[model samples]
Target chain A: EDKVVQSPLSLVVHEGDTVTLNCSYEVTNFRSLLWYKQEKKAPTFLFMLTSSGIEKKSGRLSSILDKKELFSILNITATQTGDSAIYLCAVELFDNNAGNMLTFGGGTRLMVKP
Target chain B: DAGVTQSPTHLIKTRGQHVTLRCSPISGHKSVSWYQQVLGQGPQFIFQYYEKEERGRGNFPDRFSARQFPNYSSELNVNALLLGDSALYLCASSFGAAGVYNSPLHFGNGTRLTVT
Candidate 1:
């Protein structure tokens, strides 16, 4: 079965600090890795990494994938209380018939305190 | 454009009852996927539909089924709902099935189902 594992199930940090969330996976025909931020309801998209070693960045959040290691990391710099949310990592893989489906990790809950 | 939209923000059901949840993808998007998220967990894939055809299904039981309409809207139906089935049903949309490599999924607020 395809599995995605995330480390440090929970974390607490002060505002302006940086945090790194990790995700590793084992799947067939991996295509891409995606990151999302979920607060109380739906999750919003963050970054999608299709290439290794290359980083995708937004304002304060960034992510990179390591295809060889089957892992990805999301980094948030200058974090604020608004950045507090459950960070999710998911891997998209092709099925036997070449169709795609996403397998998600357990997710890491982050708390940014002021 | 409105991102993805789901119906009935919250619902309460009893065990053995059936429930139907609806979703409308963003305008111009043709692919729709369903997922279930229990509290304190990541979303689990349920099904994916493209152009109103079933493209993929996940490890969910037969009790969980979904269909896409000609308009690209979708509905998720769960029969004999159990307490364990209570979760937030999420619907995501993408532009297409094949070229989804770099596309980020747009999600709905989700329908929160509580099975009593």
Candidate 2:
């Protein structure tokens, strides 16, 4: 079965700390991996990594995909209290030539305290 | 431009009852998808519709159904609601359902459903 797993289900860190979240997937026809940040209600898009070894960065948040290992990692530097949210990793599966469907990991919750 | 919009920001339904959730896709978007996010878990895909056609469905049961209108709006219906059915229903829309490069979905705040 196609699935995505994220480790360190929950983490707590002081402000300005750097944290790494991992996501590994076993799916057929892996297309792209996306990361989302959820505060309370809906999730907001962060980064979509399509290629391996290439890092996509946006401010203090960045992510990279390792296709060979069927995994990805999201890194947050200089973490602030605003960064305390659920970080989700999902893998896009293009099955049966159908359109893109994302299978998401259980998400890692980060709490950054000042 | 308005992002995806879903009706009844909050809802409460009893068990064995049926409920319908509405969603209007972002302007000019052709694809709409539904996801269910239970407490403390990731959002799970329920259905994806494009151009008023059913493009894909998740592992959800037949009791869960959805449809898209010609105007690119969509609705998700759940029958025989169970306590387990309580979750935040999210609606997302994208301009196209083609390749990875073209399909970037924007999500709405979602409707919170509480089953009694």
Chain A TM-score for predicted structure 1: 0.95
lDDT of 1 at B45: 88
Task: Give a tens-digit lDDT track for model 2, residues A53-78.
Answer: 99999998889999998999999999
Task: Go through the candidates in order and give the clash count of each.
Answer: 0, 0
Model 1 misplacement above 4 A: none
Candidate 1 has which clashing residue pairs, if any? none
- CAPRI grade, predicted model 2: medium
Which stretches of candidate 2 lie above 4 Å from their native place? A97-99
- Minimum summed lDDT over a 10-residue window in model 2 chain A is located at A91-100
DockQ metric for all predictions: 0.60, 0.57
Clashing pairs in 2: none
Q: In candidate 1, how many Å is residue B49 off?
A: 0.3
Tell me what fraction of the real C-alpha contacts between chains A and B each candidate also makes.
0.55, 0.53
Q: Point to the candidate with the largest DockQ.
A: 1
